[model samples]
Target: MTLYLCFCLAMALFSGPGAILALAPENEVPLHPTTWLGENKVTPVHLPKGRTRRLYFTLKKRADLMSVTVSPCAVPIEWSLAVRTLKDKPPKKPHWSSKKSMPEVWWRGSAREVRIYSYTGNDVDTYTGPVYAPASIYILRLKSNEQNTKVSAYIHEGPGPSGAFPELPSDPKVHILGVGMTSVTLSWSPSSSVVVKDGHHGSLPYHEYCVLVNHKHNYQSLCAAREGIRKERQNVQKRERREKPGKEIVWATLKDWWWQQPDALEDHASSLWDNPEDPGCVCRDVESVCTVSDLLPETQYYFDVFVVDRVNGTNAAYTGTFARTHKEARQAVTSLREGQVKWVTLSGDASSQKGEQLFRFKPRGWQQNGLLTLHTCNGTSKVKVTISSKGQVLSSEEVGHQLAQIWLHGGPSYRLQIQALVQSSSSSSISKGDSNKSKFCLKMQASSAYHRRAAPVFPATLQIKSFNKLRTCNSITIAWMGTEERSLYCVYRRQIPPDAKDIRHSSTDRCLDPEARPANERVLCKYFQELNPRRAVTTAVIGGLDPGVVYVFDVYLMRRWGLPIKYHSKMVRTRNEC
Candidate 1:
């Protein structure tokens, strides 16, 4: 997900940046468990008569977890949310096995706020999982964990543009549900809500959902049911006096162009459905326009919806995103500096966005707070390595991808901690980063392709068996059993050749063909076999020749059949006591 900015520089150069313009101020929002405090918001669905909406509230910081408990124990039902394992890259995948790792358990949690839908006697809604990070797509599940209640489920991406305005589904129409006065429900399947992009790009990608409301009246304006399943299209379109607006798709490859002056303005104001469509008489404007109808009137309601975007042309697939909204609007983001490695004591109103987020801390020319972005790859990881003045990582090698250390002229000789505030998975991971690990590099992407899986599945174990040394002279003999979680083990021989000094290149080619014995060494036998999916394979490697020389060797398992990629095992030395 990219950075969501408010308006523009004019908003910041004049009004100022920092906590004042935060959508969710440091004190108003839940503090992030692993990061510093900042802003957050729900998707919008603004209508002309903005009467019904949820109240916007904030927590101390971001919480690693937030539990939802429905009241009135008598109510019975089940609610579950599932995050796709295929979506976010997995953490681990063993090489050579050629199998993708699935999510922790397919789904994460099952539960929702009390307002989603209601339950009658003999029915209890049971939530079965945990909440997820923002912008993450998830499927909702409502089942009879206790039996008796019947309500559809859905996939929510938090909420987005549609949540603030209503529009007709271009293709397959959606079915919505209205719980109580304030609870909005939608039809859903246990399956994934957003259409996943299989591979490359070219096909139009868009997400779709059908919301099943509590009452048909909440969406249908027809005085009566017209047909059995398909409802007649609602007539709310009025002939346009001028040319139609929104004739073109607003292309925004770089987020910087989203709110850029004239470009975004055309799409934001010029685009227009200018009318209502099937089922609901909800009007469509360039921005948004939605409202609540008669359904358990006067009851507090919570509305959520998905915001769809098209990539390619007609045959495009579906991309998922959902958001929720409340009646109260929070302050817009002013200016911010998500780039500082430490609590930059220096300052300025540098730059800020209008309605969303993004606060740039650019310095004119020679200010102490030079402009820089403190980027990170695994915002959830608590590891960091310091970079030296010469650009070398001084701490652990895996702490960071690229590191850069900071130096102070006369300040305390201690490490300064600065949380990303906006990107950390939790405030804790963010805090763990705000350190002096003696040195550190600015956030950078990791280059190790070995760590690309969702869950890192490492080779479970290693087994080595020994053999008796050959009693002959000139060369000693050795043997051992070997096994690996992966395929193709590479055998290496490391021993100085007798004429090595005379050989300018020092011909110690460790990759001596396993089938052929070297002129400088001998091989009894060497070969690799496939490992069992349920278990590893065992093979023996017999050594020959070489009497008084000791040779140390290692086994490198292949993650891929022919790729240079490999994970090695501990060294094994051959005995030369013949």
Candidate 2:
């Protein structure tokens, strides 16, 4: 400012040598008398450097028809005025340009003479000086042409003249507060007014507002922004809701967001809507006591609510926000209790076939022995069964009419034991000569459900060959088979992967040890590359040992020793005795 003041002063007067001083004689040939003439000389109007400076234009409602002249400082240079109409009709597409700028609302031109006057004639400064001389420049000079500058023509900004909005029925006030995450809380307080002194024709205007976020910075009127949001919302038929016991005198308006195109939903930062009369189009406001069940999971939305009266389409009072719905949580199971029979997909067949595992068990609170157990009723084809771990299955089982009793070692703890229920032990209990089928009484459980727990102590492993007695006596060989990786194994002298292991890939290990070794002992025996599974391994005793001395044998294995059975195939005999 000080720099411009110094330049302007230098322009209209001179402080050079021989310049007429303030005490100079009247008309005594002044040194710079040519620059000074009248009391009010031309000087530059001080303005900011940029042309698009923030400017605010305010208007007051005048009851009578009179005119007022607002004195707006002429843009310093290289700037012009652009006027956008704020009418409530169709949405004019938003636009911008480098050449065609903001409209010129008022310009100095040949408009019916004597009404308005401003600088014209284009001529560049002849003096090539660094400093600007106000009197030498165009437009910059305060008083360029003749008469004490003609007053800008009067504009009757009265209530009703030519181009005036019909009287507003309400005193509309809107508040815009930006919320985080590109959201905002918009609120408005409005009171309706009457159009005529006695009749009911006032603009019962609904206070609608679009954020126009990051849009025109110096918009002069609130009504202009309100109408912009309202006009666009009408096309979409968006609904506006009310908060509570208040009368819906006004329609809810949408949050006006700036966009190049209207159809795309992605880039939109705010939700625009109208009040009911426009129902169900937008989400209901949470403040209005809406139910959670009414919403779907993972939905996106925004809301606008207002009052509607016959007198007023929508009350100016309105509010809105953005929100989403939550998803449903996992469901719980009922009916089935703990310790039930479950079918082990591979309880007995884990080793017969070589392939990847088939199924999985989601362990529940009381799950033990995850094998699929069927009814051990009278009409059943029984097979030798084995098991290792419990508590892995996570779902309940389907109960059937037939009675099934797992060779479960009944104890408080779901532990492992070596035994099998009689009825469930044979393929079919029929006499070979007489062909007589037999039936037996057994205890059956009603129902069961998935429960995760420690594998309860149960009869899983027993070491004996085919049940029928054989004629000749030879060498006794033993082999252990089962994963030594994690499960308990026994020596199944002439056995393979059980029905469950072969199918489910369970960690159930069946061993053929003469004696059921304690869980703490290493069941693994020695491994030989040539020893094939289910192949007999013979050990000869020079002198026949006592006819039936149960001999426990040990072989090297990979299970901290060797994998039993196929890997640990070898034989041992009772102390030799003639």
Q: Write the per-residue lDDT of candidate 1 for residues 458-530, one digit (tens) a residue.
A: 3444333334443343433333333433345554555645553443333232222233434343322234443
Q: How many clashes in each candidate?
A: 110, 89
Task: Please list the residue runs of candidate 1 whose C-alpha ends up more than 4 Å from where it truly belongs after superposition.
Answer: 1-457, 462-465, 468-486, 496-535, 542-544, 561-578
lDDT of 1: 0.29
lDDT of 1 at 215: 20
Residue 368 of model 2 has an lDDT of 27
* Candidate 2: C-alpha lDDT: 0.28
* Candidate 2 wrong stretches, greater than 4 Å: 1-524, 531-578
Best by TM-score: 2
Error of 1 at 562 (Å): 11
Model 2, span 147-220: residue lDDT tens: 22111112233333222111222434334443323334444443232122233654322222222231222222
Instruction: Give lDDT per model, in order.
Output: 0.29, 0.28
